[model samples]
Target chain A: MPHLIVEYSSNLEGFPEAHALDALNATIIASGQVQYEQDLKSRTIRTEQFVIGNDPTALRGFVHAELRLLAGRTPEVKRDLSERIAAVLRELTPHPEGMLVQLSVDIVDMDRAAYYKGTL
Target chain B: MPHLIVEYSSNLEGFPEAHALDALNATIIASGQVQYEQDLKSRTIRTEQFVIGNDPTALRGFVHAELRLLAGRTPEVKRDLSERIAAVLRELTPHPEGMLVQLSVDIVDMDRAAYYKGTL
Candidate 1:
C-alpha cells in the first residue's frame, strides 16, 4: 500500500466547510482506490491556509491539504489517486482567471517513517 | 526563508523537457520571493509520475511534482509561490479535460532537518 499525501495551495479559502470533508472522504471510499474499511479506515487528512508571491499585491492566499493514504507504490495507482484528488479540489475551489492554485502529492514510504504508537 | 517542496501528479509526461526546468528556475529567481543569489539559489525540486483508481477501467495516469522552497513561515508567501508554480506547471503540461493532475507543496523546517556536508 502507498501512503499518499496530497497538499494543495491556492489563493482561496472556505474549505473543510459543511460536508466538504465528508464529500472528500466519501469520494475516496467510493473510488475503491483505498481500503475504507481497513487501510484507510483511520487515516488522517488536514487542511490549512498560507500566503505566497513576491509582492503582496501579486497574489493573495492559498488553501493547502495533506492527505495520508495507505497503499502499495505503483505508478498507475499513484497517477489515478493524484488525478482524483486534483479533480475534487478543482471542483471545490473555483479560481479566477488570473488567480493561481496548485496541488502537490507526496507518496511516502511508510516503512521508512515511524507511525505513532500509543503509550504503554 | 521557507523550504517549500512542491509535488505535482497528473496523467501527462515529457516534463523537464529541454529548457522547461531552466524556465522554472529563471522564473523563481526573477520572482524575488527567494534570495536567488543566496538562500534560494541552491535548492532542489523533483518531479515524478504515479497512477490512481481501482476499476482500471475508470480514469488512469497522473504526473507528480515535488518542489522545495525555503523561507519564513508566512501564509502569503506560500500562497504566491504555490500559484506561480502551478501556473508554470499548467502552462508546461496542458492536460485534457478528463485527465487529472495534482500538485502538493510541503514547507519544510530546515533547522529541524540536517543538510548534507562533505566530511573527511
Candidate 2:
C-alpha cells in the first residue's frame, strides 16, 4: 500500500467550499484503491500567504492536501492515482487568468515496518 | 529556483548523531545554489516509528529534509541537484542488508507569485 500526499499552491484562500473536501474524498474512495472507507480523512489545510507585487496588490497562498492511502505498488496504479488527484484539485479550485497552481504528489510505500495499528 | 523536499524511510532512530543535520546543511550550502547564506536553516527532524514484528522488535521511521533553492529552471540543473541530494543522504544514513531505504524527492518550482518577503 502507498500513502499519498498531495501538496498544492494557489492565490486564493478561504474560498474553497466545504463540499470541496468531501468531493476530494469521494473521488479517492471511488477509485477503489484504498481500503479504509468508514473514516474518510483529511488534514487541516495550512496556508502560507505572500505578496506578489506591491503595485498590483496581489496576494497568494498555498494549500497542501495530504491523503494517506493503502494501495498496491505498481507504476500504472501510481500514475492513475496521481491523475485522479490532479483532476480533483482542478475541480476543487480553478485558478484565475495569469495565475499559476502547482500540484506536487508524493507516495510513501508502506512496508511491514511502516504500518501501525492505531491513528497517527 | 526550486524548493526540494527529500523524504527517507529507515528502520533506525535515535542513532543518527547531532552532526547529521549539520552535515546536511553544509552540503546544501556548499552546493552554492541557494542565495540566503547567513542563516543556514533546518527543521526539527520528525520521526514516525512502527514495529515490523513483536518477536524481532524491528522499528522504522521517516526523516524528511526540505531544502529551498533558487536557480534557473533547466533539466540538467535539476538532475544534478537531485543526484547531489541523494548522494548526501546516502552518506548520512546507509541502510542495513535486506532493508529497503526508500527516498522520494520533490521539487517546487517557485514562480513570481510564490516568492515571499520574510521567513515562512
Expressed as tens digits, the lDDT of each residue in A1-120 for candidate 1 is: 323333333234444443545555666666776643334432323323233433334443333333454335465655555456555655765464565444333333344255552324
Q: Is the docking of candidate 1 incorrect, acceptable, medium or high quality?
A: incorrect
| Candidate 1 lDDT over residue span B1-120, tens digit each | 222333334245444432443455556657676653222211222334444765666554443334454225477766766566666666776465675555444444331121211100
Q: Give the alpha carbon lDDT tens digit for every residue of B19-72 in model 2.
A: 454455556556666554323333233344444335464433444555544335
Per-prediction DockQ scores? Answer: 0.03, 0.05
lDDT of 2 by residue, A18-64 (tens): 66666666787788776776455653333322212111233333333
Model 2 DockQ (Cα-based) = 0.05
The number of the candidate with the highest TM-score is 2
> Which residue segments of model 2 deviate by more than 4 Å?
A1-10, A15-17, A49-66, B1-120
- Model 2 DockQ class: incorrect
The model with the greatest lDDT is 2
List all candidate RMSDs to the true structure: 19.3, 11.3
lDDT of 1: 0.44
